[model samples]
Target: MDELRRALQTRIEAGTLPGAVAAVASSDGRARVDALGVTEFGGEVPMRRGTPFRITSMTKPMVAAVAMMLVEDGTLTLDAPVESWLPELAGRRVLRRLDAALADTVPAQRPILVEDLLTFRLGHGLLLGPESDYPVAAAGRALDLTLAEPFPRTPYAPDEWLRRFASLPLMYQPGARWAYSTGTLLLGVLLSRASGVPLDDLLRDRLFTPLGMTSTGFTLTPSTAAQLPAHYQAGERQDLSPPSLWTQRPPFPDGSAGLASTVDDVLAFGRFLLSAGADLLTPSSVQAMTTNHLTGPQIESAGILLDGSGWGYGMSVTVRPDDISGPGRYGWDGGYGTSWCNDPATGRVCVLLTQVSDIFWNGTMPEFLHLALRCNVPA
Candidate 1:
């Protein structure tokens, strides 16, 4: 195990990555954690066990769990139309693609439901793929959504931003297919409205406080912010410049990828899911959140495989475990180079955290997972 750790460390030292933290825990009472390289290339801080990281979309599973908790408590229904909670989504329209132009084709056959958000069928796209005209792209551009610049710090204060997002045409019919979108952010909006609390406070009161995730939250304080590792682009050794001052606005409480947390904090979250709710969630709710809810290759592509891997409320299920040659593992990755997976069949959970962008599911992540699995075996 130490040899594998050394190999990972050596890789980072040899420039395969900037720095990383990896941990593995199993139901059989075996665990291993290792930190490699420097937290910042030019800083003196060594990557440590409790280093905070911008977890990005890795926040999805936790947020999904919270939404499911609301469902279990009868505060919300998965099948309920989201527009019922926020009338802004009512009478929404879908876009019919036209060459060099967009046409507002028709009203949706049905209202967008809470389940759609969980399934990524809410018509917003992540804007990186070929299908760039998805609602999130249009909405982000229309509202000038940029996270690099600091904006109003209060939640839901960016009403004009959300209004623009609500007005954009959907990329596809609700529940017709799946696309990784801002559905999680929409879920955050719904959660705040339903719970009558700001998104950050709800996360703290509901999940973080109970799970002992003290280092986790949406907005970073100056002290915590200073501990944050600089984010780097893949293959680039230099830190990426901060976004323009004008683009620094906090657009909305994005449930998908807005939170920052530590590897240990997330390990507790993974264990909670694996144990089927230790304190913050119910067993049934956890099961429902991890169960596959989408069918067919509704949103399959080279980059995002939506069919072979099952998607639950906000998780990616291991449907054909053989397809990926992994056990009955279920979890998701963040766009900003963080990933966690729990293999129920093997009773093991592995987490990797870094500040490098676009490294999820790429060579860096796969290599780390390979080492973790190798280290999990008994001598």
Candidate 2:
């Protein structure tokens, strides 16, 4: 455990990151949890074990778990069209080409399915490379859809957000290609509408409460806001300071990237999935959610983000082992410099939390992940 702490401390001292909290648990009962460095560079607040991080896209897996629960409760079905609950998306248009104008479109080959949302096959999402700045992505930005930015969140309520989203044409036809970001956002609203509960309340009643994840939610009250570290990009502080963006619930509870959580809370989520939902979700549902749903071509289309991995429901599935992990390990990263993964082969769950977004693109995140695995896993 000290090895893990030391590794993070080394990075902190090296100016790679401000601070981090990490936790690991294995099925045979071996476990380690530790925190190192300060909340931010040169700050007096020591990073505590329970400090909350803006888990960002890590919110997807939790939301995906709740969606599976809804599937089990008969509130939703995977194969069914989502138009029943999301009538705003009943009629949809798709761009003819990745660079096509917003009005250069065709009717959707089919309605977006519940499975599409979970699997990220719902067409419109973040584009990469040359197509990234295409008209559709521009339209999404103009509408304040908050498609991919982790900070500076959407201001519209769910209904208005959905209305704006539905007004645009999908980049690809539903179920045609695996895109990123948007589907999970759609699932957030779909989950709320289908259950007739607000997204925040639904997540609380169904997932967080059941898992005893006390430190996970859409917003942190003022009293607990101190637990949130100063978020950063590069070395400068971001605007997401304490008692601000995360203190009060945003008009939109972004299912894709809008939750603050502690490392243990995320670790518990990994454990829940590793336990095959442990009574909250059926084994089959867990299987479906963790299994790769992308075709090879679709994976290729996903480009750098997939990075030769596969996407299951809301998380990335490791189809091929790499330096940091083995095949069948399933987890997701939060754009805000947090990583969570569960390796069923070793029955190990690992979580690393930090507030610097640059670490993901920089080498720090991968180094931390590799070190965490090496420190804990027996030879």
RMSD of each: 3.7, 1.9
Model 1 over residues 73-124: C-alpha lDDT tens digits? 8889988999877888898877774212345566788899998998888865
- TM-score of every candidate: 0.88, 0.96
- Model 2 misses residue 135 by how many Å? 0.9
Runs in model 1 deviating more than 4 A are 28-30, 98-103, 127-139, 146-158, 237-251, 299-307, 322-327, 377-379
Q: On a 0 to 1 TM-score scale, where does candidate 2 land against the true structure?
A: 0.96
Per-residue lDDT tens digits for candidate 2, residues 1-379, read 6666777778888987878888888766567877888887788888888888888999998899999999998999999999989999998988888788889999999999999999999887888654355988778888988997856778899999999998999888899899898988999999999999999999999999988999999888776776688888877788744556667778999999988888778878888898888989999999988999999899887889989899999999988889887888888998878889888887888898988989878787787777766666442
Regions of model 2 farther than 4 Å from truth = 129-132, 240-242, 377-379
